[model samples]
Target: MVQLDLIELADLVRPEQLVAEILRQNPQMPVPVPLEDLARLAGISKIEAFTSEGFEGALIANATKSQGAIFYSNRGPRPRQRFTIGHELGHFLLPWHRQAKFQCTAEDITSGGNKDWEIQANQFAAELLIPAPLVKTRLQKLKDPELAHIMALRDEFETSMEMTARRVVELSEYACAVIFSKDNVVRYPVWSPYFTHRLCVKKGERLPAKSPSREAASDPDEWHELDAHWWLVERRGEDTPESVYEQTLVQENGHKVTLLTYDPE
Candidate 1:
């Protein structure tokens, strides 16, 4: 079992290293390596599901060389399947990961960061697919940031929409946030340090009745700027202090993704 910290793992095999090693192993393609190839390189044998129910995914036990398998239900989208496989691979490689066959839900893979181990697995999966260095390089090329840029990155890297959005919120030079809400209730949100101190959006809080998320049901652009207190708690009888850039993305199932972006006032 290899033991190392997050920074050490980042130093050892970044996304570029992973890509380079994949290409070296399979010279037929210069584009990003396939997920199966990534699994094979990481020593996982096969990715298949058990004849079981109520399981989103799992890792097979007792494989040689600490290797494992990734099991998933067939009902998910292709991008989700790829993300699940990457998450399971994270468990397989990280020494601090639990040994049990991980049965994950969509929420688990997306918002399971309350625990240290779960957070580590999430970081591992993110870095494995879209290294921060690559993202940083790409961000350098763009003058204006938007959801289109994130989507382009996702398609370029062949990763999922959620992963791309999360990465952008993490790496954006602008003050940015990505809120995941279902049924108009807050689920999970990734925020920058600027928002961390003052912009507190509590879990399960209903969307602000006056926010664009409630009324802007038609615009599907990449980004927008709006009032700050519109999404933050306002002091009673105080004038609205700041404004924020609000980018709203509505999924097929009424899931709302609102990206709050603002510069320090």
Candidate 2:
């Protein structure tokens, strides 16, 4: 194993660059990237379970010591725990991450705040778990971006469907978006760069009346064609309407994920 000082490893600003460098160093690194092993290799002395409430995980260190322990909530699901470990590792490795000790909440790990460090850490975790190159190859081979495909990716990658879906949108060539909602209220949406349409609904807004997400309560995992305007804010004076493919999946946790793909035809 190559000895990488914090400063040497932390120069990269982008998560992709960091992940690429990590993989470059450990060319034999396997899929599902053994985060705990990487943590240990990167100066983490131990990964222990914590019974703390509110916080998902934290990094323990001081100015004097480069190595530290990682603590994660024992109650979180295994997948979430893995993500938390990766998130804390990012905080440890990134030179720009100034906090010697970090206590991250669920939202900090998931929704990622406006703070640069939090966003970078979240990106690092996501890329480390589901490397963009692998995800891009998988997306290219898929005939259709269905809920089942996302679920399969989740299982194969040992990650949450939400994370897998977000990765799909981030790397896919198709114009697509994944909207997550709880109790019919939009929580957040991730969109592919090629997706030109702007989502009309904002966070905390109810699912549009005409949206297939509205039918998720009755018929989950169903796909339907919707008028683009139903989801996307229309361009002023534009008369032509495009068709958007919509699929809704109701998670066991009661969160609804609606996958939207624009017609490429």
Candidate 3:
């Protein structure tokens, strides 16, 4: 493990609190959040590629969580690496994550199972890389919400489209939703807090046959009009609303992201 510059670490326990302290220290933090630099600042001594076949990232530190080395696999998409780095850093910093070493798999980083430690690490990574305040401020300055806006955020924040999309949903005031699908099968879906429509989404559910994400495959990242029922669960006695706008961003392979907005006349 190569040595890096050692910086003073903080005593905050919660993931959010520690990130707040980091932001407080680096008031002029830039977009895309110089993540590795921040990791080094938080006491990580070295970060190198890990050749482990299935693990996304790992942390090597003593029982007291000092003198840390982070490892990330080079095989995944480049966008995911930063998050993996942030995850290991989380494991290194959280006082209660008492493990001397952490070898986090893709599932552990992306979607943790029953382990609270992995879940907290994921939270730390998300909040550290994409601060909530920044997202809210950026969204307020933008015009009408569009999937293109999310695409722009993906680039600006240096995060995967799905990650950026989920962050936006967590803070957006508009009644909207994001759906991630592959080959017309829903994999993950998230809707804004303002969304009141009962969605039809279920893991492994077939995408609405006529949804724009599939029908307008030729034009990627374009918004189209559709009925709210396209993604909403219909009420037993009421008709589904009309004029729900959908903007779909087609991704590599069979992946697709559809943004839905509920606006009524």
Candidate 4:
């Protein structure tokens, strides 16, 4: 495989653009994108397994060259490992990511950070793994977003459930958001442009009393309509409608994903 330099890759400033260029160049690339193969083709010398304690993945460049090797944890699930590899590859291909080495933790790969490079790399990995165009098409076919639909999309894309949920929110026609929490505390929330209402909860905040996420502890995968005040803050004197729906799914590890949808009418 011929080594591809930054100039040869897309010159776009955003991660999504870079991914679009890659897909344009290789129209036949299969779903669940061939990350390892793409890495090798993009000048990654080796994809080695690491048993690191604190970090999920690392990209180390040679002292005299720009090309390097990618090392990912062998202990994480396959989906996670694939995402890590794609994230590291983003760091490798991004022109401004000039660091000779990068050691990234699980949070670095999974969440948006204050650093510009980390955010760009995450966007890149997401688009590479679950191309937005394809996701948009699939979402258009759904009459309503459901936990089962999200799970099926995750399995079809061979990506993490959180990733799939986020994509669903991004592409949904209705005002929607996906909240990830652990032990009742909010971790992060991803919402769509149409979702104008502000979420009352913030990172580390406990779930609202009437939240389906709280009920999910007992009945793991169920959808229910909760009072709007339970999750949204209404403006003074504004009439709050009762069309808010929430579905929560609890994983075996106690993490919860709550999908919120609102109907203004």
Candidate 2 versus truth, CA RMSD in Å, comes to 2.7
Ranking by TM-score: 3, 4, 2, 1
Q: List the pairs of residues colliding in candidate 3.
A: none
Candidate 3 lDDT for residue 35: 81
What's the TM-score of each model vs. the native?
0.75, 0.88, 0.91, 0.88
In lDDT terms, how accurate is model 2? 0.81
lDDT of 4 by residue, 51-169 (tens): 98999999998653366999999998988998999999998888778787999988898775677888788889999999888888788887577888888889888899988898888
The lDDT of model 1 is 0.66
Error of 3 at 64 (Å): 1.8
Better of 1 and 3 by lDDT: 3
**Winning candidate number (TM-score):** 3
lDDT of 3 by residue, 92-195 (tens): 88889988899898899889778999999999999988998888889999756777788889899899999999998878988888888898789988988888
Residue-wise lDDT of candidate 1 within 226-258, one digit each (tens)?
667767667776544477677677787778777
Over 4 Å off, model 1 = 1-33, 49-52, 61-68, 96-108, 113-118, 194-197, 222-225, 233-241
- Total clashing pairs for each candidate: 4, 0, 0, 0
Local distance difference test, per candidate?
0.66, 0.81, 0.82, 0.82
Which of 3 and 4 is the better model by TM-score? 3
Clashing pairs in 2: none
